[model samples]
Target: MKSWTLTAKLYVSGLTFLVLALTSIGTTLWVTWNLEGGAAAVNEAGRMRMQTYRLALAASTSGPSGETLALIRSFDASVALLRSGDPSRPLFVPWSEDSRQRFRQIAETWRQLRAQWTADRPTAQDAARDAGRFVALIDGFVAAIEAQMSRSTTLLQGVQLAMMGLAIAGVVAMLYAGYLFVLNPLARLKRGLTSVQRGDLSTRVEVDTLDEFGQLSAGFNEMAQTLQSLYGSLEDKVREKTARLEVKRQRLADLYEASAFLAKAPSLDALARGFAVQVRRIAKADAAAVRWSDEGNQRYLLLAADGLPAALLQSEACLDTGMCLCGQRRAEASIRTIPIVPDPAVSMGNCQRAGFRTLISVPVKLHDRVLGEVDLFFREPVALDDEDRDLLDTLATHLASAMESLRAAALERETAVAQERALLAQELHDSIAQSLAFLKIQVQLLRDAMRREDAAAMNGIIGELEAGVRESYADVRELLVHFRTRTNEEDIEPALRTTLSKFEHQTGMKVRLEIEGHGVPLAPDVQVQVLHIIQEALSNVRKHAGAREVVLRVSRTPHWRFEVRDDGLGFDAAVGHADETHVGLRIMQERAQRIAAVVRVDSSPGRGCAVTLDLPAAAALEPAAPALGALA
Candidate 1:
């Protein structure tokens, strides 16, 4: 009736059924005992009547014999037991007043019959009549017990019917209670669980009672709410991660494209313009400009500009004086954002007039040295965050590196041109110029001989002049061949072989070229100069040494050494002469010195000639020699 736990309800129901079963058992046992008691009394009364008849017959027939006397005693004991009211023994009977009167009459008849058998030995007719009356009374007593047993049987049937009705009613009540308190709520909970299993987190058990089911329902609802909240938060986190991945992917693509563009740009201006365009696209800015320091002129120069108005582009105040917004910000040596305000000192009035609202300046730095600044302009007042600033800073760094590379390339080109011109001038002065001067002197001699009217001298002088002219023409052709020779192969061995083959073919002399340390590489400029020096040595051997055989040996150990040995009619080195041969020797020495190499001439008048050039390993690998100033 009141709210209780499931355990308490079950305990109470079990106890009630136990009590009802015990009551039914007790009632059935009591009714059965009363019925058995009435039947036993009837049986006792019938046995007593039969014993009294037998005693009467024996007395009438045998004239009070011993058998008759024993029968009388036995009969008397049975009647006394029937009349006793002892409740302990089953044979004892409790009788009403009418049954007691009937039992007394039977008892008195048995006594008269026993007295007649013992004292007078009555006639057979009297004895028979006495027996008849006793038998009739016994029958009446049995009839009374039978009637009482009938009443007990009817009461037992009534008790059994009442127990059956109570058992049926209890069963019905138990089933109904179970349905209301247990089965119905269990079904509801089962349905709610099914819904939740199907992903319906909104489903909740609606049981509202102060019981176990109520507490279970509340806990289930709390769990569902927690799950829903967690699911929502997980979705938010996934979306945030997806967005971040997309942004990182886009940034990677932009960096890749920027690196490709910057690498191929040919000059500083082109690199700057390309870099500005890429940065503007990456940062989503309106305009971009690059300005670099002109240390030579002590001013900053605008290298390139993109998407800026013509009026602002034409303004030379920023270029002439380092008073512009980017120039002022370059001193900070970091990326910064500035508002484009009308300030004369800052020189941003042109930017303001051009409708630019904000400026993001990124200093182009190389190893902590600020070379320039890249300026990004925006129409709206924009605040540049760290990510935006970092992007611009990276672009500026790449731009700075490209600019440095271009500068180095331009410097190398100019140095190469100057060196070539100096080499050409020295070659002309040493060979062709001297030969032309000698030819002029020979012509002067021929004119003098002709004026003196000596035909033999004039003819000899003409022969000398023709020889000089031929020698000069040969020198010019040799110079042309040397200058036209270019080493296009990646390795120097091929070029060396080509030069050796040409020398062998032109001079009609056997030239032996032996190379050691075959794979050792020399710098491009070093290889070129060494080859030219070798050519010069070979030429000297051909023109002056008058040698039949020459050996050109290029060996590399700790350093490189170029040797040209000739078994020629050698010249004396101690006696110096201002001749074409000495001039050729001087040109060879100068070529060797250009690469920081040392040259040695081992020769005598008639023995042989051995010219060797030894180069340091470092100078061969990296030819950082200064320009030749004045070669004597």
Candidate 2:
């Protein structure tokens, strides 16, 4: 390519300016010659003819009427040049010869009229009357001619001045064009070329013209363009390398996030799931799966996976571990292969057939032992790079550590549960079993005393036997319900109602049982405890109070509320404590406490007694379950 300098283009533009200046000067001279000569001739003719016509009119005015009229008309013919009138209308300005001749006739007639009036006026008195009218008419004609002459003079002067101005403007425009198109463009090109020569290959020239100058400018532009393109390509390569570095940095960041997540995972399943999720995001894989060795088995179990078919994940021998498979095939395998199902809706490659395709299974090896393997797949086959393999290996190590800790925790929880069950067994045998045995012995003693009939001896024995029997009964009932040898499963409401009704049947006392809401299922231990409480309350009513009717109302919300009201000879409950006679009351209070319920008694000397029990519904249903109470 050729280069153009500022001096070469500026010299060409200077010649172009000189030619334009000369042409403008020649044009101005030609226009001046035509306008000045033509306008002068017209003005001279108008002046001469106007003076001649005025003199001729004056000369004919003093002759005889007919002869004077003839003289006025003949000499006034110069007024035939008075062409246009009413100048504002389109056809009013009479420029044609025929129209001018018609106007001459009008001027001639005016002159003849003046000659006749002058001839008829033989005296000064008559002449004076018409003189004023004749003078006024002549004055109007002269004024009209003068005004037309002035307009012609102004128009010619304007034309001459416009020609000169145009010539000057043309010269100035040529000089400006030389600077804008040639000089400025060349100057820019010179600086740009210098920059390019100094190793700034990105510099470029700006040229927009259409002559020889423009052609040279275009050549310089092309040269700069070639250098710019060469350098731009090199810069693009650097940017590509920088972008790859950024991608590697992002991968390192993802690894740290995965490490933090693994540290917090509490179980083997959670750790495996977290590893698979991170792998899915980093690789942009369609699905990810993890398989680990089961604790006591040689076979691999699928621990976790995303977007894998449930049937294939659960099926035996679905994934291959690289070592055994590589040995069998006589190949040094880096990753094992399996069919991984991609979600049809989410997979980008929807044009392919619907099913599993290729999978890349990389083993998670911790030290010398193979803990598990991770499988990643795409809708289309993906070729793994060395970086991908290494990153996966790091993730696998972290996941293995997390899984080992989780396994140890599971074993610890199992041991704790076993110890708790053992302690519960010991408590039930030591306390409840012994109390039930003592109750059975005392019941036999009471029966034996009743059989041997001796009057005073019988009376004292009956009192002793009744007190002993009451105490033994309270102990035995509490043991069976709360500290049970063998727990029984019974619904809470039916058991409670049946126990109260049985006491009424035994003593021939009227008892009313009312239940509200619907019956719910209860655990056996909870039901037994609640039933014994009701039994104890009823026994207290029979033993101490000489009341007739009793009402047992059972209400259930999220918890149970049992109320036992007896119309018995009530005692002041606050001032007294449970003795051998009131041992049943003490048993009822103890049973309510064991079940995490509240028991209150309302009694007075002359009023009836009402015992109320409010237990959490879960406690009234299951001994071990946590209670969900009502909102209020």
Candidate 3:
């Protein structure tokens, strides 16, 4: 009647059926007890009647014999058994008024018959009549019991039929109720679940009653609604993610293209123009401009411009810090965006007059240092989004890196030119210049001796002048050979040997080259400088030291060391003489300084010269430009 959970409903149904089954079992037990009692009574009555008849026959045939007395006693005992109600023998059926009266009459009749037989020996006719009467009474008693048993059997059969009908009806009702209340609802829930598994979020279960099944159905419907809402929003989230991935892919492709273009742009101006074009295309801007900082003159120079008016490009070619929109932002070293407004400031007037409504200025930086700024212009009054700003920032960074690389290359070229000039000056001062000066002094003395009209003096001076001219000619040829020398091998030893052999052949001097720590690495620039220093020292030996032999030793143990010692006339290196010899020493010192090396010239007027150069081990191994001689 009341709403119940599935478990409670099932329990109640089972309890009701159990009660009915117990009732039927109890009824069956009662009927069986009554039938058993009636059967026992009928058996006892029959036995007693047989004993009475036997005793009467014996009394008639042999008046009061021993067997007859025994039969009488047995009959009396059986009668007492029927009459006495023993507590041990329980009765299943209570004795009704009719049954009790019939039992009492049978007991009384048996006692009367026994008393008659015991009192005297009657005639045969009398005994036979008494026996017959006793048999009749027992027979009537048994008939009464049989009738009672028949009634109990009939009642038991009816009770069995009734209980069976009730049990069958209860079982059928229980099964029907289970199907309606539990099975049917479960089937509906299963169907809904199957639908949901097939991606049908709209499926829902019907709530028939306020029971567990109803609650479960309600929860399932709620879940379906939630799933429907989530499924709908999932599409939007997926779309958002797809769009983001596409943007990132496009950005990566743009960055790859820009990097390739920047690497091969050739010049800073070309790089700037190419970068501006890439920025305009990637950022969807109407125009773009690149401006570089000229810190020496304190001006921002317009390096390149795209999609801008000629007038504006000319006006903005060069501007001082804070002179215009780009310059003002560059001075601050920050990125800025100019929003479109009716009363826009005149600082961006040039861009506005060029049909640009919005501007974004991004500072191009190498680390924290700003090299320049790139300006992007839009035709409409469009606000820049974060993606656009990010793109511009990336472009600016690439531009700055490219600019730094170009500047480094230009510096390298200038440094090489300066080194060549120094080498040329050193060569002239050490070789041709000194030789020519010596020859000029000889000619002057020869002219003086001839004017005195002294033949011996004139002849001696002429011979000295002839020797000086030959020596000068030899020096010029050596200089020419040195200028054309090339050290194509990575190792400097072969180049050194070649130079020394040429010197020996030309001067007719014995030269020796010895190397220790042959595998020690020397920077190309350091090696070139050391070799040139050794050559210059040898040249000085041939010209002034007048040494017969020269030894060139190169070792690399604790540090790189080069020594050029010659057995020739040595000069006082400490003397402050404005001479060509000191000029060559100064040139060697400058060459050592370029690679952070140390040069020591040890010599005296009478002793041979030992020139040594030492370089530190930790210097960068940058390759120097080939010597001027190689260039020639």
- Per-residue error (Å), model 1, residue 198: 9.3
Which lDDT tens digits does candidate 3 get at residues 1-632?
A: 43688778888888988998898889889888878766676777777777776787788777667887888778767666666633345422235666677778767876787677777777888888887877887787677677778888998999899898987899799889989888999999999999999999999998877788988999999999999998999999899999999999999999989999998889998999899899888878898888898644267888998898889888989888777667654337766787644554447777767778888888888767768888888888777677767777877788888899899878766766776676667677666777678878878887887888888988887787788778778777766766666666777789889989988997888999988874556666555667777777777777677888999888866777889898777888888787767777787787777677898999987788999988887543554444422232
lDDT at position 466, candidate 3: 83
RMSD of each: 10.9, 19.6, 8.0
Which tens-of-lDDT digit does each residue in 1-632 have in candidate 1? 44677777768887888788788888789768766665667777888777867777788888778898888888877787787733454544535566677888888877767777898567778888888888899888777666666776787898899789978988987998788778887888888889988988788788566577767777888887887787769889899999989887888789889988988998777888888788888888899888887654255677788899888777742564356656743346677788987775677788888899999878888877778778899999998767766777777788888888888778877786787788788899889888888888888888888889999998888888888887888788788768866666656778888887888888888888888875457777677777788888888887888888999888877678889999999878877898767887898888887788899998898988999999887864564543332111
Q: What is the per-residue lDDT of model 2 for residues 1-632, given as tens digits with 9 covering 90 to 100?
A: 12444455556656765675566556555444433433443453345345444434443455355654554455444344334222222112213343344345446655565555545533444444444444444454444434544554565566557657756775777677667765776788789778978988767665555656666667877877776786779788889999999989988999889988988987676787778888888878877877776433244667778776555455533334333321111123246554434455433232124253666767666555666667676677666678877887777778777777677667666665664455345434443454455556655665676676445665665676576566556544544443332233345555555566567766788988888876566556556556666766776776678889999998876567889999888888777664533455665676677677888888998898999988876764466332211000
The backbone clash count of each candidate, in order, is 0, 3, 3
- State residue 307's C-alpha deviation in candidate 1, in Å: 1.8
- Report how far residue 29 has shifted in candidate 1, in Å: 39
At residue 249, give the lDDT of candidate 2.
95
Off by over 4 Å in 2: 1-499, 502-508, 514-535, 539-548, 553-562, 567-572, 575-597, 603-608, 614-632
TM-score for all predictions? 0.58, 0.33, 0.62
CA lDDT, every model vs. true structure: 0.78, 0.60, 0.78
Number of the top-ranking candidate, with TM-score as the measure: 3
Show where candidate 3 strays beyond 4 Å. 1-91, 94-246, 296-299, 330-333, 419-632
- When 1 and 2 are scored with lDDT, the better candidate is 1
